[model samples]
Target: MEHTQKLIHKIINLTPLSTAYEHTPKGKRQLECYVKNTCGITAKHLARIYRVRQARQLIKANPQLSLAQLALECGFSDQSHLNNEFNAILQIPPAKYKKLIQQ
Candidate 1:
């Protein structure tokens, strides 16, 4: 249990959108298993969530921030990628969210 907590802490501290497992004979599988078993989510999902969370924070903090810049800043591949992921996670695209914030 203690080991699990420690591992979770390590995994949680990893940078956003970085789900690369360590290079070892079984490192990737073991890390994937640990992430799934402990977090109840896949590593890719976790990374995606992290990126969206960052984008949300940026949007809220800087209402003037552009979606294109936000996408690049938050590690999204492009504006469309950001839109897709943002909509998936928050159920609202960044542009709409910005508009709502403006009103």
Candidate 2:
């Protein structure tokens, strides 16, 4: 939809990637607004999606890292927490996903 694309472009133009997001309510509000206006998704879902992507990158960087370490680095509670989210977003177990990538 042109309207959605325009909204996304406006948001991207307004919010720089270097903007700090953790210390202020305004940043959180902006993220929530962008998610709603652009993707019709919730901030909670977006956060999980971001964490999963970050976890993937971390795994690639450190293939020897334990799942627990990856989870902690990505802000999840522990290995099980990361596993739960990874499964929810990726529909596969984290171990299997890691093995598949290694091979």
Local accuracy by lDDT, each model? 0.75, 0.68
User: What TM value does model 1 have?
Assistant: 0.79
C-alpha root-mean-square deviation, each candidate? 3.2, 6.3
lDDT of 1 at 55: 88
* TM-score of predicted structure 2: 0.68
User: Per-residue lDDT of 1-103 in model 2, one digit per residue for the tens?
Assistant: 4433443443333322224343234555665676577676765565677778788877777777899889888878799999999999989878888898798
lDDT of 1 by residue, 1-21 (tens): 444444455444544423344
| Model 2: worst 10 consecutive residues (lDDT sum) | 11-20
Where model 2 places Cα greater than 4 Å from the true spot, the runs are 1-34
